[model samples]
Target: MTIITRFAPSPNGSLHLGHALSAIVAHDRAKADGGRFLLRIEDIDGGRSRPELAAEFRADLAWLGLEWEEVRAQSTRIAHYDAAAEELKAQGLLYPCDCTRAQILAADPVIGPEGPIYPGTCREKHIDPHNCDGPVAWRLDVAQANRKTGPLIWEDELAGPQTARPEMLGDVVLLRKDPDTPASYHLAATLDDAADGINMVTRGMDLFSATHVHRLLQALLGLPVPRWHHHSLLLDEQGRKLAKRRHSPSLADRRLAGEDGRALAAALRAGQLPTGISCSK
Candidate 1:
């Protein structure tokens, strides 16, 4: 099978160095394997997603000396996500949740890899999907889902084999409360990968734990499984991960400053990061 990889980035902010590393890794990996590279705009957050930012993302990638066989925007695929949610709901694997972040924290939820694992407040209520009144998030009945799937396993290029443990995330939201935008990250990403024929899911290590949940979703949805490459994350001098919210320097900034993008891409390939940036395994 031809190796296919994608760099899926949310267009809520500018593309920073961390984003650069991830895009380069995915792009070069496809090239080295004689495969195809794709670019996906994860603009599902209607409230925060900006069309201008998506256009900027494309220019940033081109400036980084990267090319893609195709591009996918999540905004165009809401119907598919709703269909998947309906299927899961039919199987009794999804439940309505109205709990807010503060409520979950008040319960003193166990802190998981993603922080503050949901306390299953609504899961205990057994809210009837049909009776759910106004704006309520749909959550996966992870414990039940796990029981249905039995033991599951997925492989990471770096971490080898991993057992599926969706419970660690508790009952994660599959659909948000907002009717205009319902699909959650876990649901959309899994469906998108399968739809795009992505056989190699190359991304940063930060999402390594998410693969477990994705594996379970694939089993439940009867989607084809893909191998993953969880590469190292780019961090700042203080060892914190580079983030757009933190005002990390962006690729667009570098481009406007007359820096050679190809040279920077070459340097990144050689593990030569910009000043105060380091890689964490």
Candidate 2:
């Protein structure tokens, strides 16, 4: 199969250095293999997503001399996500979850790879597909879903072969209360990869655990599987992962300051740390 990869970024904030690393890696990998690279705007978060930032993201990639064969936005594909969610719900593999972050934190559940594992407070609550009282998020029944899919495995280019362990993350929220974007990152991304014919997924190592759950989703939804390459994440001077919440230095800022975006991309490709930036282990 022809190698295909994508650099998906949320337009909630400016494109930071960490974002550049991921984009450059994915872009170059596709070019090196003479394959297709796609740019996807993960702007499904209704409140956080800034549509204007999507244009800035495109400019940033162009400044870095990276080009993509196609571009798409998650906000444009709500029906596909709803269709997938409906399929899982029909099979009784999903339940309406009204749990809030504060409530889950207060419950003091086991700290898993992705922070506090959801306590499954609303696991038993069933919502009528035709009539729903109020807004509620959709959570996957991992245990039930797993029983049907049986043992599962997916290969990561960097981490090698791995068994599916979706249970570690607990019942993940696949859909949210946002009517405009009912799909969560887990559900949308898994489906998008298959829909885009992405045979290989290149992303940060931080999302490694997510692949396990995604594998299960693919199996349950009958989506095509893709190999993964979870690369190291860019870290700050404090050894913490670079995050948009922290206002990490953005590519736009650097570009405005007359920095050479191509040079920076080359340095990242060569594994050379730029100034205080470090690769997370």
Candidate 3:
């Protein structure tokens, strides 16, 4: 099978060095294997997603001397996600949740790989959608879902084999209560990868734990499994991950300053990061 990889980024902010490294890694890996590289705009967060940034992302990739076989925008695929949610709901793999962040925290939730794991406060409530005054989130019933699938495993290029442990995430939201953002990241990403025929999932190691839930979702949905390459994350001098919210320097800024994007891309390939930026080993 032809190796297929993608660099999926949310268009909520400018593309920073960390984002560039991820895109470059995925792009180079595909080219090295004579495979297809794709670009995906993860703009599902309707409230936070900036549609204009999608175009900027395209320009950034092109400026870096990278090419993609195709591009997919999550905004155009809401119906597909809705269909998947309906299927899971029908199989009793999902339940409605109305708990807010504060409420979950008040319950003394334990911290898992992704942060505070949902305590399943509303899991057994069987919330009636019609009776509810507002939208309700739909969370996966991971324990029950696991019972159906039994033991499962997935491979990471760096970490080798991993046992599927969806419970660590503890009833993750598949569909958010927010009307503007219907599907959660876990649900949309899994479906999108399968839909796009992505066989090699390339992303930062920060999401390595989330792969457990993705593996479970694939099993439940009967989607093809793909090998993952969880590459090192780019960090600042303080060892914190570079983030847009932190005002990390952006690729667009450098490009506008007359910096050569191709040269920067080449340097990144050689593990030569910009000042104060280092890759997490």
Task: Note the residue pairs that clash in candidate 1.
Answer: none
Candidate 1 lDDT score at position 235? 95
Question: Per-residue error at 242 for model 3, in Å?
Answer: 0.8
User: What stretches of model 2 exceed 4 Å from their correct place?
Assistant: 127-133
Model 3 TM-score is: 0.98
The parts of candidate 1 lying over 4 Å away from their true place are 128-133
Q: lDDT winner between 2 and 3, please give it.
A: 3
Candidates 2 and 3 compared by TM-score, better number = 3
What lDDT score is found at residue 236 in candidate 3? 97
Model 1, span 1-281: residue lDDT tens: 78899999998899998899899989988889899999988988868878898888888899988989656699889999999999999999998888888898999989999899998888879776566666789999999999999999999888898899888888889999886567888999999999999999998888888888999999999999999999999999999999989999999999989999999999988999888889896
lDDT of every predicted structure (CA atoms): 0.90, 0.90, 0.92
Q: After superposing candidate 3, which stretches have Cα over 4 Å from the reference? A: none
Candidate 3 accuracy as lDDT: 0.92
- Alpha carbon lDDT of residue 138, candidate 3? 92
Would you list the rank order by lDDT, best first?
3, 1, 2
lDDT of 2 by residue, 136-255 (tens): 888999999999999999999888999999999999999887786678899999999998999989999889999999999999988999999999999999998999999998899999
For candidate 2, the per-residue lDDT at 254 reads 92
The positional error of residue 225 in candidate 3, measured at the CA in angstroms, is 0.3
